[model samples]
Target chain A: MKNKGLLLVVSAPSGCGKGTILGEILKDDSFYYSISATTRAPREGEQDGVNYHFITKEEFEQRIAQGGMLEYAQYCGNYYGTPKKEVEQMRDAGRDVILEIEVEGAMKVRALCPDAVFLFIAPPSVEELRRRLNKRGTEAAEVIEERVSQAARELSYADRYDYIIVNGELEKAIQDFRTVVRAEKLRTKNGNKIDEVLNHA
Target chain B: MKNKGLLLVVSAPSGCGKGTILGEILKDDSFYYSISATTRAPREGEQDGVNYHFITKEEFEQRIAQGGMLEYAQYCGNYYGTPKKEVEQMRDAGRDVILEIEVEGAMKVRALCPDAVFLFIAPPSVEELRRRLNKRGTEAAEVIEERVSQAARELSYADRYDYIIVNGELEKAIQDFRTVVRAEKLRTKNGNKIDEVLNHA
Candidate 1:
């Protein structure tokens, strides 16, 4: 296979700072973090096409039917899917793309893009996760409990991941993530580049 | 399942530096690198139980019959196998042990130690591997040709490994090997040390 950019699929429970990591990776010169398409309504101050390619339900379904969606799913009655064109374009143009999704969506993307690297982000433990959720202080006690319980269940699927990052220390976690990205690039796909460097030297 | 040490099984073609990397790892102070017991006559300057545990053919067969050998194979009319008791003792003492064996022997060890990490080292390409083999200089041209042909057949089994490392660059390959070791240790054995590191912080 020719040397090309990578597709990084990241999944994490709610409040695990997947968004924050995504934002940081976008600032990296080596990556082009993708904006997904969603039928869900945008929150205040979110922009169309920038934050997400917001569209009507009919439009979303039409794109799916036309095979424009790489992976898509419905959650709480709202549809979300990754656009196939932009991600492929960025990779072909030599920029790796990041796809941050839920575990279910990550599995979907894995089926669609078998070469994509799968990463699972986890908190320290159920107790630490609950502490983080409680510290948010923006949700009701019942809602916090529900989210914590959901996180606990989701963690059971962590063994399925190629790499699991414990998101307790930001610096260390980011370093580990970057190491995985770099090391994966040196696999068979771009491994020749290193050889070329050595041969010329 | 307890926080016990792991048996790591690594295999590769002769020039892939499996021996060198395994030797570097033995210096970690927390690992016990397994020495094979063999029935082959020792070469000059070779030490018993250090270079190899030289034994008589009759003694080697006795160990195999008694199930004392973790993995054994006869190559060129000589017996070689890893001793089970020493490995178990090292692991029970919480010291990781590495077994650097050829592919055939690795398969046997995997059957005996199911939880062991099985890694295969590959060169960037068959052509590059041939060049390295030729550079060794001790081998006759016919022998080099035979080894290269053997390496080509071995490449087909690369997928049998849990992780594949292409030894195109020495330092990078070493780093990749270190990453696998560190990441494997992070796996939750019984106490989940990675989780504890996250939680306590």
Candidate 2:
């Protein structure tokens, strides 16, 4: 029996280094990173489908009305949302799809996709998070402070996630992410071989 | 703060090759395999606590009456049980404990340890199971038939398990077992680092 792919959603606070880990995993090509559809105008170098599924505001609203958007948000007078049909189609095709978004967006996805595996990446400690943010050296001190506080607020919502991975070490975190996806495939809700085996008997 | 160890229970049908996979994992010494206590007399080379926790019938009865056993059974004239105190102590001390038991005993453990992780190992197919049993050559035709039917009965209870791993290739099966353990450790209920990280902040 062909097992349906996993619909995985991940949420992480700033400075957790989850981006690096996700970058490594997405390189495997086994996963389909979800691309958002938006009403925002494409920038000079942005491609319609590659960068974002650039769509008209009317169509975006129509998709929302038709319940095609998994999760959506309004920013700077533009609408952005994950296209649910693409995710569902990819998953039904036995291709795992990943959605890396913020905690609020993850919650919206959770409401829409109850079976999606929710993973929250956390830093080892708040001090470590601050140190990593400071090490970037690109942000001003006030900006760094703002991000740290935002991270703390985000951590408050971490418990709402199904799984929490403490990103203490990069290698261990990547392995944990992979393990979570692998194990979720074997979950009784996701896939069970017993019936398939018994039927084959 | 140190995270509590995993309380894991495994149930598998005959010929699933779970024993071989478990043997490979137990070589790590990170797991404490639960040993059963019994009232049967030790035969040659049977050592106390090694083969079984040899105890008198009266003590076994007393332990059962005191609710010390997580699960118990009687066969021929001997009583056998898993002591609950030791499992609790090991888990509290951050030592993971593995309980490889039948479906019945696993259900008993479930009632006692609500936080336990339950895994069901499955063969590739019922035909493959029969093939493996036949290759053993120790059992007669009728005995093999009995086991095959019993396996079907056990498969009925597989849905109650939290995760199901199909044992096809030995190496993949072993890795799947390890991945399940790793992912289970990251579950929100098992060892959530949110509070620990927040408290440290």
Residue range A95-151, candidate 2, lDDT tens digits: 889898899999988887889999999998888899999999999999999999999
**Local distance difference test values of all predictions, in order:** 0.78, 0.88
- The alpha-carbon lDDT assigned to residue B73 of candidate 1 equals 88
Model 2 lDDT tens row, B43-161: 99999988789999999999989999999988898998898898889888888898889999889888878999889988877888899999999999899999999998998889888
Error of 1 at B77 (Å): 1.7
iRMSD per prediction, in order? 6.1, 2.5
Which regions in candidate 1 have their CA more than 4 angstroms from the true location? A1-7, A85-96, A107-116, A133-146, A182-201, B1-6, B15-17, B66-68, B88-94, B107-115, B122-164, B186-201
lDDT of 1 by residue, B1-201 (tens): 345777878778877777777777777988888899999999999999999999999998999899999999888999989999988999888888888888888877767777887777877777777788888888998998899888767766666666677778777778887776666655544234433434543
Docking class of 1: incorrect
Worst ten-residue run, lDDT, model 1 chain A? A192-201
TM per candidate, chain B: 0.89, 0.93
- List TM-score per model, in order: 0.77, 0.92
Best candidate, lDDT: 2
Every model's DockQ, to 2 decimals? 0.17, 0.56
